[model samples]
Target: MRKSAALALAACVAVPAFARTDVGVSIGINEPGAYGRIDIGNFQPEVVYAQPVIIERSRYYENRTPVYLYVPVEQQQHWRRYCHVYRACGEPVYFVQEQWVEQRWREEHPGWRRHHRGWDRWDHDRGEHRGYGY
Candidate 1:
């Protein structure tokens, strides 16, 4: 009975260790579903709000130029809660409209899907040299 109880306890602890799983995906600038700073350059981007949103006011940010960001609508509405994610809690930020981001991505990456077809297969193979290697 003592051996059976100990084996059961060990199995309960070991099972969770083998069952744990973690997955992460990184989205970079100009990609769909990306959320971070965007370089507007000389051209002006359409923004969701006319004025820049300032979550925190401090003397340090007074002379700094405002940054443009492409964030989810929910994050924009709750800037105070999500500002730290972009590391712009105190800096002035202009949230670009989602429509503009989609348009710009389409214009800039017209052949992105076709060009990256083989790359996608290569990534799926986890760097194994298959015939689909780019």
Candidate 2:
């Protein structure tokens, strides 16, 4: 049953034949959220990966440096699509339900003259890939 299900999913996505069994899905939510989805042969769209983002402050490490991590979105033990770094052409990048990146920087990395913080996420979104970007 599991073998057929995985094969069915692959066929639905029109993916090259492979040997695998079992399938599943998962997702992650992070601040400065950015999200996107790609279609797999008109089948159900599934998230294959995402960026790992968290906000915290400490006296040790320089708070000025932005924290970045990769997150994985998956479904049916395969990847389907991923979110591109939300950007407005010449504008700075951002994520889902987001806009003011510069404002976030100021609030998070206060008292800093110029700080560099940014990243990009890539996705294979294929067969439960462990994809991430930051």
Candidate 3:
């Protein structure tokens, strides 16, 4: 009984120590600037469409970065289709709510220089994406 108990205890500690110390390390080192699924180069659209459901802009980082997209209620389907094209590439797509637009605006224009009262409020009422300058 004592021998069996000691053996079990030893395994509990030893097994984990040698389990997978190098499991998640090799992939990251081999493919620099790559996460589990995200492709840094493919994070943003290569060519901006004349009109799109959302204008997605992402800044690449070691970890996942928030995607700045503008998708309204009616344009949701269009956005889904755009995502489908990239699905085969194994890229993960994330959608930030409408608030992201405002957040982006604030980040770009810090401390308020005036002459921009309605700049933050986007008119999503228009079903078509203006592809407006961001």
TM-scores of the models, in the order given: 0.60, 0.16, 0.25
lDDT of 2 by residue, 39-74 (tens): 122222222224323222235334333222222334
**Whole-model Cα lDDT of every candidate shown, in order:** 0.80, 0.33, 0.41
* lDDT (10s digit) by residue, model 3, range 8-35: 9999999988886444421111121111
Best by TM-score: 1
Of 1 and 2, the candidate ranking higher by lDDT: 1
For residue 67, model 3's alpha carbon misses the true position, in angstroms, by 6.4
Count the clashes in each prediction. Answer: 0, 18, 0
> Candidate 2 — number of clashing residue pairs?
18
**If the candidates were sorted by their lDDT against the true structure, best first, what order would they fall in?**
1, 3, 2
2 against 3, candidate with superior TM-score: 3
Q: For each candidate in turn, give its C-alpha RMSD to the true structure in angstroms.
A: 18.9, 24.1, 16.7
